[model samples]
Target chain A: MIQLNLHKTLSSTGGKMALDLDLTIEKGHFVTLFGESGAGKTSTLRMLSGLLKPDSGMITVGGTTWFDSRSNIDLKPQQRKVGYVFQDYALFPNMNVRQNLEYALQKNQDNSIIRELLEFAELEELQHRKPETLSGGQKQRVALSRALVQRPEILILDEPLSALDLKMRIKLQEYLLQVHKKYKLTTILVSHDIGEIVKLSDSVFEIQNGRVIKNGTAADFFGLNKTSAKFRFSGEILKIQREDVIYIISVLIGNDIIRVVSDPKEAALLRIGDQVLVASKAFNPIIQKL
Target chain B: MSIVCVEVDNGEELMSVVIDSPESAPYLKKGKKVNVLFKEMEVAVTTQKELNISIENRISGVVASVEMGLLLSRLILETNIGEVIAIISTKSLKQMELVERIEVVIMVKLNEIILAP
Candidate 1:
């Protein structure tokens, strides 16, 4: 479990922002901090990783006290076993993929972890390739693997996929999930993209002005059923039949064809191929259990 | 009931809809000219060719644009009927592989249809 009650004062050329936050995250939970730029999302991550010291308050992860301002107990960055991935990937241009992973190892550590990470990230084929020769996606994989070489208890990713294209971003999301599950690492991601938050996070904390304003599961924020009392579903228009002035429109909704009655004037506006929404607030929609 | 004229791009006759007043149904006889309206939230979008639900309003159109947000994506489609907008999850957008010009189906519940004469 991770427990934090941190207070910090930040001053940039823009102005001063106070960051006062209290949060407790369960172990192995994929949590995301979502906010706009300069909202202190990255500051929170840096504080957790011991790269930034809090002005006041405590931060404890898995019973290991990383910070306590009152007692002046602050652990060094290297002392905190955290795996961090930055947006630029920060891979060494001079080193090959295998060398990069090996360099992150502690003194007297075995090289077996390097081989394991290379296989886990599917970079064994390109292990000898330098960072300059690798693609953007490949460099990110190396960075991720290098971070994991330490077997960190906490994994922090600050917009790691922001630089990649949509296709590569999707692929890396899967990889991140796999590594988080396999290693049982407590992962914290900073993202502005709602889609990425929903796709990966178990819970999301919405930050505004350097403070956490809302917290909930992805479903709570985006579930369709939560939006209304009326019945809703997506389907396609299949056929339109005219009987006198009333038009019957056939809609295919998941293998079921439903016919709706409409007036000729209203029906005239709809084509056979037009995507339309069917809704009614008058009656209670029946729910059948299969 | 509120009546509004909808202009279609294909030069079809102007479409009118009566909205919010269901009591106007009795006066809406055959061949009667009336306007139709439905709540925006009542609309849903899907890429599936077939669905098993009992919804009545189903229309297909080509995707015109998709505005992706952190949680919801606004999709606009141009169909023969008119331009329809849908707000769905970004996850669904990706899973459906919905992009500009892709054909999709829009569904709405029957009772949610509001008419104004």
Candidate 2:
């Protein structure tokens, strides 16, 4: 279990604010911190990893005190068992794919994990390719694989898949789940993807103005109580147009963008770049072999 | 009708809210034997044991197994009454920890109980 009671003064584009957070994530459970940008989601992760200093409060992971303001105890990032994956796929520019992962290992650490992770992430063929030569998705797979070399029990992902396209992002979500389950890691993710949160996280914390305002199981927080929808597809809104008293909304699902007709009210609620779930009855589709 | 469903691992009690089971009203009695009939859409799964709700008949069962889909999830519950099958939102299953071996309470309304003489 990880317990965090942290206070930090942050300076960002939105202005300075005092962040106060009190949260607990059970072991082996996936948790998400969600909110608008600069909501202190990233800051909280950084503090927990010991990258940023918390002004006061306690941070405990599995009964070990990582930080205690009253007692003036703080562990360095290297001392804490944390594996961080950033949004940008922060790989070393000069190192090849395998080398980037090898760099994350501690001195005298066995190199077998590198081979295992490469195969697990399907990066065996691209191990020799440098970071700049790999595609965005491949780079991300490398980043994720590298994060696991240390076998850290606490995995922190800061918008790791937000930069990839929809298809690639989804493929990587599977990889993340694979590593999380295989390693039995307690994962903390900072994300804004509602569908992803509902699919990946056990619990969600909604942060606002550097404070945690609402927290609950993903189902309750998003009001995902409607169990009647049997046919559902998550996609992004690309365009909205009107046709003869009705609205046509275009959604990008996987590689194909399909147009769905929606009522005027629901069309008005959707905007470009918004993630949406196109749901209907199960028997509506006529499947054909191509 | 005797509904025979094979039980699986998740403990012994799971809860599902069954509705829209409008039975033949003439068949219900203390000493009468009747069959219950309902469609898959009529059953809803929940975790509440005791609460204020419209459901009248509560059958507590344990989650036996789950077949998960993209949006909906199918769960089999083993109870003293019998094995009940329910469909629920996938999100609810993941968040509620309603996997195999977990005890849950399944509920149904009085009017939803169909009785066939």
Candidate 3:
């Protein structure tokens, strides 16, 4: 369990923003900090990683004290069991992929983990390629592999996938989930993309003006079900048959076929292959994760 | 009567209630607007929080008015979304100690909601 009571003050164009937070995240849970810019999302991650200082309060992880303002106990970034992956993929330009992983090793540590990480991230072929030569996805994989070389307790990701394209981002999301489960590490992420947030996080903390305004299970917090009258898969029209004045539109949804009742002209403009929703009065909300 | 319950967004809130088939209520389509209609007697109110039951349609509101009678009582609940009217047995109403302005949770069963377009 990672528990924190953090307070910080920072100056922005909007004036002094006070970041006061008290949040408890369960162990092994992937939590995302979501908010607009200057909302103090990134600062929270920095404080946890010991890169940024808080004005006051304490941070504890799994019965170990990481920071306490009163006791003046502040561990160095290296002292805390943390692996931080930045948005820019902060790979060492001078070193290749393998060397970057080697750099995170402790003094006199075994080099076998380097081979393991290289193979795990599928960077065995690109082990000698410099950061500049690697694609955005390749560079991020290297960065992720390098971070895990420490086998840290908490993995901190600061918008790490935001720089990549949609396809790459999706591929990286799968890698992240695999890594999170394999290492059993508590992960904290800062992200703006709601799609990724929904895909990756078990819980979400929505911060605004430096405080956590909303926090809950990801589905409950973001999934409002505000769309049309609750058609889970909103089917597509495959065929339309005239039954007197009314029309029966055949809808092909996934592998199932559900027909919809429609009047002439839609009640106007519903054609074949167009997405049609079959809303039934009996079709009700079945509480499920979105 | 054979019924169909549909959910409606009354500009401020999404109200749902129902039982209907595609043939019974053909007006209900995806991305279309509809009206929600349910009975006052169908609205159930309680003061409990974070319940784990199967009621899907719910709202938190305060009693706008209460008309007490010997056998039954009528309650008008005012929520940010809209108002909900409820009718309950006077005996149960007295047991719950309900009064005007008292915050309460109103719930409706899935089949109780009716949709009209």
Cα displacement (Å) at residue B60, model 1: 28
Number of the candidate with higher TM-score, 1 or 2: 2
Candidate 3 CAPRI level: incorrect
Candidate 3, A249: how far from true, in Å? 20
- Complex DockQ, candidate 1: 0.08
User: How well is each residue in A1-290 modelled by candidate 3, as lDDT tens digits?
Assistant: 99989999988899999999988999999999998999998889899999999999999999999999999999999989999999999889999888899999988888899999899899999999999999999999999998898889999999999899867887899999999999999999999766677778999999999899998886556642332233334545778896544466788754468766554545368777674445433354466788
Question: Please, what are the lDDT tens digits per residue for candidate 2 over residues A45-152?
Answer: 999999999999999999999999999899999889899999999899999999999999998999999999999999999999999998899998888888888889
lDDT winner among the candidates? 3
Which wins on lDDT, candidate 1 or candidate 3? Answer: 3
Best-to-worst ranking by lDDT? 3, 2, 1
Runs off by more than 4 Å, candidate 2: A226-228, A253-259, A281-290, B1-117
Cα lDDT for residue A66, candidate 3: 94
lDDT of 3 by residue, B5-72 (tens): 34344444444543444555565555666767555667889988678888877788899988777767
lDDT of each: 0.77, 0.78, 0.80
- Given candidate 2, what's the lDDT at residue A232? 56
Q: For residues B20-109, what per-residue lDDT tens digits would candidate 2 score against the true structure? A: 122523322344443444333346667777878876556677899887767666787887767777767788879897889888887754
For candidate 1, the clash count comes to 33
The reply for model 1, stretches above 4 Å from the true place, is A222-225, A228-290, B1-117
Clash pairs, candidate 3, are A265-A268, B3-B19, B4-B19, B4-B20, B5-B17, B5-B18, B5-B19, B17-B113, B18-B113
Deviation in Å, model 3, residue A225 alpha carbon:
5.4
